[model samples]
Target: MHKLNGSFSTGYALLTGLMLIALAPASSAQESKEPDIVPAGETKTPKTRVLELGAKLLQSNSPLKRFDIYLVGFHPMKDSPEDQMEAHHYCHQVNEDFAQCALFDGNTADANLNGIEYIISEKLFASLPEEEKKYWHPHNGEILSGQLIAPGIPNMAEKSLMKGKMNSYGKTWHVWDTGHEGKLGTTLPLGEPMLGWSFSRDGEAIPGLVEKRDKKLKIDTSEVRKQREDLKQYAKPQSGVDDLKGKFSRPTRDIPGVIDQGNARSLPHTTE
Candidate 1:
């Protein structure tokens, strides 16, 4: 685990203070109705404190920032409905259209790594072939339903930020299943990667878990739902990677724990 040196830095403390303010209820009624505004309460856990400090430090130096999103309707095997898992994502956005996220077993930061998700713009997604598209998922349900959220930003700013992400696609694979066992095992589980999907309909997410998340975060997802009504038309259908009707295997060329050399070639080369 990563540790912070000394006490929490002044910059982190200040950013946390601002986040608290930004998450509070406004004094005026007009301000309350603004989509960009939401409320937050005090921090509770050591892990959260660490994450806050880390997020502050990262945002100070780079364009990276974090958002928490909940996802369900997952199955490790194609035919097994009993193999579902619930996951929470801590996403660090690298830019407007690209983000790499770490997935956790639950809402808390201490939860073990369930998997990772890479999100990219529709343009990048369109560049992929039809077979490759099956491994990806759409963001419409996660966004319009208010399941995907940036916690600290004011509603308007978050709304504006999400506007760019509204049409984006995500490629995710689950490596851990906390539900089957009480805790994560010592080693990486050996199996084909499980493709993840978002809740496609009302009440698809576990109601109890959703309530717990809203209560813990002190933000009403229903309000977020209302605010994003206009963006619903932009929502992508449950096709391509979103289709879960058939038995799908992991891409033959996509190996776990190995970076794709072909894809890496597109990255900018740097020499010392």
Candidate 2:
């Protein structure tokens, strides 16, 4: 919906390019009440593009640039190959799966990057009890952990879910579930798993696994700003939002000639 390239008026910066490059289709039609529309095959207009950690993408255009930088640079020990592979799958899944409800959501990679921002903003912040403010403190390294926000699944490349319980005493607790088993009912439109952000019957910001959040769920704008700041380091300099939307509107099984050797380096199975 938003024009991605114009944001990078100064030319493709490395992080901006990476974020654009990372753009993927939305996982759902309306995620936390946002539009995710992008056209596929349209090359990104990057502000900056860089190849880091063998292969990782980030964006700097959004307001939450800091989160962009942090996400890519985090975990210097580096993620295991398995973790990396799973991460990619989850990201890819987020892109494709968003198409179920609406024609499409914004680029999933962008959305994925925003996922951190989303958690910190609307989900995590609002979820926090007014008294438990320390946990949301910026100094806590754990705040950066994808697990802290929604540990249901720790793969940014995959869809996230949240679960809750009805205690014996009629109380409730939080549970998270990440991992996609595909969508329900082949007959459904965009029959991918109920992945990504979708409201529950109760109107809560339910992760895919969780059944509900609240009626007025919305992504936190402040968190969105911070994540954008952090993610700038890994954000793609290119503007792939248009391409991402196009690809989602009329997707293909695979692009055929596009060989992702970089991704394959970390994920052997990704090789064409």
Candidate 3:
């Protein structure tokens, strides 16, 4: 036999290896399977499904409306000129021309009963005599002051919602003074409901209350104030306006009972 050259021997060995790879009993597809590929436009994860359901539920819930706001005022019988800041959570709904709100002392689930607020449409508010209007506070000041905030809402959405409430009037009465005592008293204080008002200016509210609230809610009241500058026209003018001038003791005819004198002096008044 002729002696094989090294080059030819190497070429034969390479060709044999290639043939073995091609002929290797094509491994059953089941033995080495590729990962299942999610077809284009057909992927849906558990998280996405959950988000869709949440959106649908939010759209279906119509009657329940909730907001967290701060009301500033004091006991009706107290003559001391001071500002009291009370945190309130309002769940209100409007049917026809009437609106009713359930008020809570704090914004959380553990919050206690503070009081209730009633609102009427502009037509209804207009029909009331001028004297009756004093008991109702204009919401424009509350809306524009950046003090009355609705938590868990986008800034633009909150502003749009407040626009609808601009002309609306609210008559709020506080049953519990949780700000002072720290807890809801065992029994509901017996007396006329203390009228609650909104902060109309920069210094009218408690110095740190608004700031603390803004921090907790991750909101900037200064930005809200800037956005509401155009709403000033809707606000009631301070000229001859007793309501914004620390004169909130007027008794409303809607709720029964005279102003209670004993509870007025229970808490020390803080000066404006």
Q: Provide backbone clash counts, one per model.
A: 6, 91, 0
User: What lDDT tens digits, residue by residue, belong to model 2 across residues 136-242?
Assistant: 22212212112213211122321111111000000001111122222211112232222122110111111332111112122232352344333222222111111
The window of 10 residues in a row where model 3 has the poorest summed lDDT is 29-38
Order of quality (TM-score): 1, 3, 2
lDDT values of the candidates? 0.52, 0.21, 0.48
Residues 42-73, candidate 3, lDDT per residue (tens digit)? 46799999998999888664555333222322
The numbered model that scores best in lDDT is 1
- Candidate 2: lDDT over CA atoms? 0.21
Question: Under the 3 Å rule for N, CA and C atoms, how many clashes does model 3 have?
Answer: 0
How does each model score on TM-score? 0.56, 0.17, 0.55
Q: Where does model 3 exceed 4 Å of error?
A: 1-83, 180-191, 233-241, 246-272
TM-score of model number 3: 0.55
How high is the lDDT of residue 26 in model 3? 22
Top-TM-score candidate index: 1
Q: Which should have the higher TM-score, number 1 or number 2?
A: 1
